[model samples]
Target: MPHSFALQRSSVHSTAFRRLAWGLLVASWACALVSIGLSLARWAAIGHAMDWGRWLPVTVVPAQAMVAGVVAPATMDTAWRWLGVALECIPGLALLYTVLCVHRICRAFLRGEVFGPEVVRGFRGVGWGFLAMFVASLVYQVGVSALLSWLASGQKAGMVVLGVSSFEMSVVVVGLMMLLLAHVLAEGSRLKAESDAFV
Candidate 1:
């Protein structure tokens, strides 16, 4: 029957899409994991150097003055300043992959596919990823602040600036908490939909 053939084709297409979405998710997570690992290794190397008193504070005054004088006036070298644009693309692409996965999961749930557990697991994984990154960032910032304070004793103005900048650690923590909350909401919605169908 033509109807039966069409149904089989649709099912195959759905399976293929699911496979593609899962592949994207796995690849994205792997990239993030590798990036985090590399970052940790770099941090350890830097910390070891600092511990041996092999670190010297770079005089950023000249660089700051030059930027303020020329870059601020023309704003022409913005593209040049953004040389790390490719590195920045990693996170952007990973987040886009997550969004696509979430959308796919949502669509599956709407079709009564019962992917609730998968969605919950995926959400938890994302939440944990965010939390780990947040904690690592906080640790790095705190260590840097302590080192700077030790190196620049009696520089009250510099210490105050560094202390204020360190408050970004709190922002990271809050952002991770929000990400966890988002996962919870998404999982809860899927659960609710299933429950309503049973009712």
Candidate 2:
């Protein structure tokens, strides 16, 4: 009965939303810090890195053909390594953006600004962030493939690989769903304003 009572208390806006606000703020910052630390570690490892190509998306040649004297070690150096690291970090950055938007919405709820313009905008921002994640993933795959390919064989332009996986398609669906939610919130806000004016 006590557990059920706590569950029931969660239905109250102020209690639940304040909890969510603080929880998300803490978790988001923690994950963002971890991600940055990992990225820095990877960047620093670029110098003495073997099997680094295993961390990257593989660049396939047509028919898996290998020209004689082609570079086989699969290495990235100089500006290429920086680009690779930046590409790897982009998805994390996108996720951070989404969390930031969620944090904003949570803050609004904590302040009793439920269904306010800030929350609506935050939802839209998160929707765009999800879409940005999908886009960034595509760019990462393509860019890494191209970089690896060019480093392998200068004459080969065989990096035209393109395919959509379940995760990519799933994020698109989620992004659209978030956008729909934002639209619904906008409509609800309109109705609320109308009712308030009527009152």
Candidate 3:
């Protein structure tokens, strides 16, 4: 009777957790969509205002000199700066995809199919998604920095900062961990099949 009660309790907990995860995912996905829409609108506005009729925002900054001989320009192409802003947001989109994978995993768990191949595959998807996000973020930062610097090459001092952030490194580590978990799940699923065959 105690074991039966414990099993029921655990089932209830899993169900509750699944429901909560679904709600949170829906809310987060809505927010992400809104954010992406707003970003696109802002970029469109900037692009329309460009001097070349290319539609981009413009900003003017005072000239600076890192050394006495090297002078910088007071103005640069700040128009397509919206592109950089948009690029920076790529990770958020990747995370949304990851959330979808997690949602699938949660569904499988709710159905008590936790050790199934589908669950393992979903875990693998999540791991790869995180890894992709990390790579995309790094590319965005470095690429944007380089592009901006090149645009300002004639006047403003070109600056490029290339380094992996701690947060990015952490995400990479998390991705690796997820992949490890997927491997464990694969083994578990294999063992489960073997045991079931005996039964």
Candidate 4:
């Protein structure tokens, strides 16, 4: 009777773990899509004359696919094509990392094992990395606009418009907010670890 009860409990735990994993996967992909969409919208609003061509969809779809299955490539390049590649890879990497962390957390919880402080620290690091990428992209957009405007009309209005676009500001704000949320999650994880250790 006890053996049967233990088996049933184990099955329940496994089901719970699977549910948690699926939830994490969904959330990660949704966040990735929203972030990438906002970025593309900002670029479209700013670089009106530049042809994004295959770059826009290339950047977004690959990142989404990475969330769904494989990890995207991460080769660095300065060319516009390579820039699209890098954009896809950056979010792919971030989503992969987050998924892994969430998986670990779920497994530990299912096993009644305490998650370590490292998990929290990893979350914070990933968040900060995303923030840095957003800032760098924004700066790049501004710089490109400035150069193009200077070449055309000797005025910085293009750069200013690019810098102050609604989408750009939202991206910056959202990135910062995500970073803050990561820090909070990390602290909470650390607290949980400490509490479990005490018990």
Identify the leading candidate in terms of lDDT.
2
> How high is each candidate's TM-score?
0.37, 0.71, 0.64, 0.41
lDDT of 4: 0.50
Candidate 2 backbone overlaps, count:
0
lDDT of 3 by residue, 18-63 (tens): 6875676577567767756664454344323235555754532211
lDDT of 2 by residue, 1-199 (tens): 5696466455545565678778987887788778667755554454343554687644322211233222222454667667656766777789889888988887787776666689899989989999998997777666655655666665365353345778899999999998999999999888878876976
| Model 2 pairs in collision | none
- RMSD of every candidate to native, in Å, equals 12.7, 7.1, 7.5, 10.9
lDDT of 1: 0.45
Please list the C-alpha lDDT of all candidates, in the order they appear: 0.45, 0.69, 0.65, 0.50
Residue 159 accuracy (lDDT) in model 2: 52
**By summed lDDT, which 10 consecutive residues of candidate 2 come out lowest?**
61-70
Per-residue accuracy of model 1 over 1-199 as CA lDDT, tens digit each: 5697578457646766667666765676676667545533432233122333556632221121222231111121333223223333444444444444555555554454543556555555455544444444344334434333433343232221112233446545655764676577677768668876976
Off by over 4 Å in 1: 1-16, 43-114, 128-132, 148-199
Sort all candidates by lDDT, best to worst: 2, 3, 4, 1
- Candidate with top TM-score is 2
For model 1, name the residue pairs that clash: none
Candidate 3 has a TM-score of 0.64
Superposition error at 69 for model 4 (Å): 38
For every model shown, the clashing-pair count is: 0, 0, 7, 0
Give the true-structure RMSD of model 2. Answer: 7.1
Instruction: Point out the higher-scoring one by TM-score: 1 or 4.
Output: 4
Off by over 4 Å in 3: 1-14, 27-93, 152-157
